[model samples]
Target: MTRCRLCGSQATASVVDLGATPPCESFLAAGQLDRPEPTYPLHLRVCTDCWLAQIPPLITPEETFTEYAYFSSFSTSWVEHARAFVADAVERAGLGPEAFVVEVASNDGYLLKHVVDRGIRCLGVEPSVNVGAAARDAGVPTLTAFLSPETGSAVRAEHGPADLVVANNVYAHIPDVVGFTRGLRSLVADDGWVSIEVQHLLTLIEENQYDTIYHEHFQYYTVASAIRALASGGLTLVDVELLPTHGGSVRLWARPDGVAGEPSRRVADVLAREKAAGLQELSGYTEFSARVAKVRRDLLRFLVEAAERGETVVGYGAPGKGNTLLNHCGIRPDLLPYTVDRNPYKHGRYTPGTRIPILPPERIAADRPDYVLVLPWNLRAELAEQLSYVHDWGGRLVFPIPELSIVEGTS
Candidate 1:
């Protein structure tokens, strides 16, 4: 029985079983041809006691993040999102020159650059060597190590307590939730705010985004679950906000006990909404598995039918979520010849299990396939609009999840 990682609760309720899958970003290298890639059992379970929705253990941070391939600076939307988040934090926190800002899992200093530009003392704690090197190249001071209680205490001794600690999209990645949260508790000053952004579990179920399930992402968080985990370390949530990035996400601002300030109405309102949606009950997740299975079946049928008609189909976006969807549905080069990505580093590589070659976005215009499968369906609207010229040849853009549908026209 897979026990909850946070609390030693053995009563784990199975949420959604995505089946065996490789690490989402484990792209095949030329030297790895002979080495058989390992695939782990990928399934999510909800802790009945803590309501923590997480995938069973697989890979560690050292194994997954070191020499990482995914770079945050590659995404245009994410860059802009990071910029906006920095602006919001500065104004809301009343940040000034005296304030020391720290960001955990700060990949390539995507958000920290903005904070540094304003002459704010900031440091980024990142694990990935390649990304940390990039952060240094960009003139952002970064510590290349995983954040833990000991490390946090050490950093605090050197730089003093941070006024604002921003951990964006990292609350879900840590294996030891308790230790990581304790580290945040230690590093932050009494009056300082610790803000974390994570993809909301409610949005994942509502959008039927089973593709978000992967090894790197250990936990799926809701507002209630987040508060419960934070409260374990004596932190209280003071504010919360919903964001559209990565389908849907929640940004939470927390502080230690007796912090002065009224709890934001949005925080209470979101928690109530989560309860109303039956997140506290096991039945909510039970229905999701059936819905996801249906999606897998329908996507396979559509691809098989299209192949029978001798139609050419290619994929767009070599994102981690896209890899999960393709690998779970058991898609191959037969259905998707090759996917294209804007990231230059990923352009010449191939996806893990399926080994579908990842090419540049320009390949779509050159090839002009009959149908283009938008695997990163969340960004389908933006991608479809950009590639609307495929309509000149009567080609359609197909989105698989939430049912496969083709939209005509090119921007």
Candidate 2:
């Protein structure tokens, strides 16, 4: 963190220091419980010179993505979201059966399956071996590799240049931003479209969604910073859309600078919103550290009082963001007991630093805990309906972020 990764600037300011925590996705097995887990500094800093918010590159992308546990198809809503995006992209980009679409970091073909169904030619560049095999099993063509400039050129040479290159939720995972953008340009046609979806820093700050900060995400982006980041590789921003997924996100439409005209009104509007909110300067970040501290205090207070009252409180989902919230707040198995997830890969494993046991979703209904702390607060609507059966036992749900709130289940 001595220098900004995006721009070579020595002038930087501390936004929030989350202390040290293990890589959020490093789940532990029963046999490894006695071994000491490695932890890294989790402090977040912002570059005043470029306004780019980033954490130190403590861990490499290969260490985290080689054998990933997260599968996008597990969530019904997420799969549907991908399906809708594909349908819209086809019409918007003038894509047809003759056109080719390439998706970088395409997880388990959750999106390309829709493309396949439409009779459009598509290939997925996925990093995880296990998930890439699953995508192939589902009849989706996938290449198990990470996107780099060399890899992109080979793909173009073999399969031809892509008419539409879609990169969703992976703009922040890459530490080498400029190199990755060059890779994107190499894979796309001279006048092709490049669409990327990432969580918006403006919403992350305004809504107090601090749990999203983790080692996997190297940098956070506002519309202003994103415009500059994309420009580093000859990609120009032409349009932008605000999305509600992942708390709040931005869908950026870019193209090779050759055909990129003036940006749309939406891009200007979002940038103006960022400026008005003081994210361009230091004023907006001044009070963020205090707000983050308050969140940790409130969550701990509720859990401690519940324990004293002889009440059983368990967690609902085992998301990566949940690990950040759990470790930062010093929550262990004694407070949460265990958390459940639909992803079977995490079953019988333990969370990285806090060592909370992860069990199957069926465990919740069998044990009947009094209150279930919903860890994946971003999926509030989808999970509430799925967990509605809790109401039969007079159980309620708790959300820790955007302020702690307890509510009854949906009937």
Candidate 3:
């Protein structure tokens, strides 16, 4: 039996089983299609002891992230979010030229570039060699290494403790939750703060965002579970913010234990909300498998019906979450002929198991398909605005998750 990564308990209850799926980010080149691709069980379990929803690490970090393809800079909304975060954090923390900043999983220096432009000394710790090299080229000094207790200590020793440590959307990628939190804590000065952004488990269940589950994300954390995990590493939750990014995420601000920072009222508010949502009990997760199964059936039915009518359907965005959704629903190039992405790296590549051809966003305007399946449903508004020209050709946008819906108008 696989033990819980957070509480080390064998009382892990199976929540949802997505069968088998290949690594979501493993986009394939045309030449590599003849080779065999590996897949692993995509099962999620919740620890009865700690209520931490997680899956076993079937693949190593090196296999999933070492030479990553997903770069944060590709998303315009995400870059704007990063800029806003840098501005607010710098002012709130009273950061200046003397104050040092560090960002973990700093993909392509998207956020740190804002900090650097402010004349602050900042460094990035990114494990992806390609993204790290890109960050360096973008004028952000970065170390291409995975953050661990040892690496964190070394970074602290080499560049002094950080006044603000930012870890955006990276807390879930870690298998060792406690160790990762400890490493984050180690990088902070006594008066420093650590901010982590993660997609909230409550939102995942309520919104039927099962697509977010994949091999790379080991754990799905509730506010209560996050607090326990951080406390295990001697960190205290000082504040919490509900962010609309990534289908509803929570940005948590923490400080070392015994610090004087008062806990924000928002922290208690979120904890209460999670408890009321049944996140603290196993029953809360029991009905998720049924919900996920319903979503699969609903999405497949829509696509199959569309195919029967001889309507052409394409996809938008090549996000990792979209890969899980497509593979789970057994969608192929037939159902979704090809997907468009802003990232040039993914252009001309095929999705991992589904093998859907990825093209540049410009292809959408050229083909003008009857329907465009917005794969990254989280960015529906932004994509709708960007692809408004589709309406000119009587093309409608479709969202497959949270119940498949056809949207006609652009926001």
Q: Best candidate per lDDT, number?
A: 2
Q: Which candidate do you rate higher for lDDT, 2 or 3?
A: 2
lDDT of 1 by residue, 301-393 (tens): 988998999989999888888889999899999889899988787877889888899999988889889988887787665777777888888
Model 1 regions lying over 4 Å from their true place: 260-262
For candidate 3, the per-residue lDDT at 218 reads 91
Instruction: Report every candidate's CA lDDT.
Output: 0.88, 0.94, 0.92
Model 3 lDDT tens row, 79-107: 99999999999988899889999999999
Candidate 3 similarity to native, TM-score: 0.98
TM-score of 2: 0.99
**TM-score for each predicted model, relative to the true structure:** 0.96, 0.99, 0.98
Winning model by TM-score:
2
Superposition error at 147 for model 3 (Å): 0.4
Residue 407 displacement (Å), model 2: 0.6
Q: Is candidate 1 or candidate 2 better by lDDT?
A: 2
Clashes of 3: 0
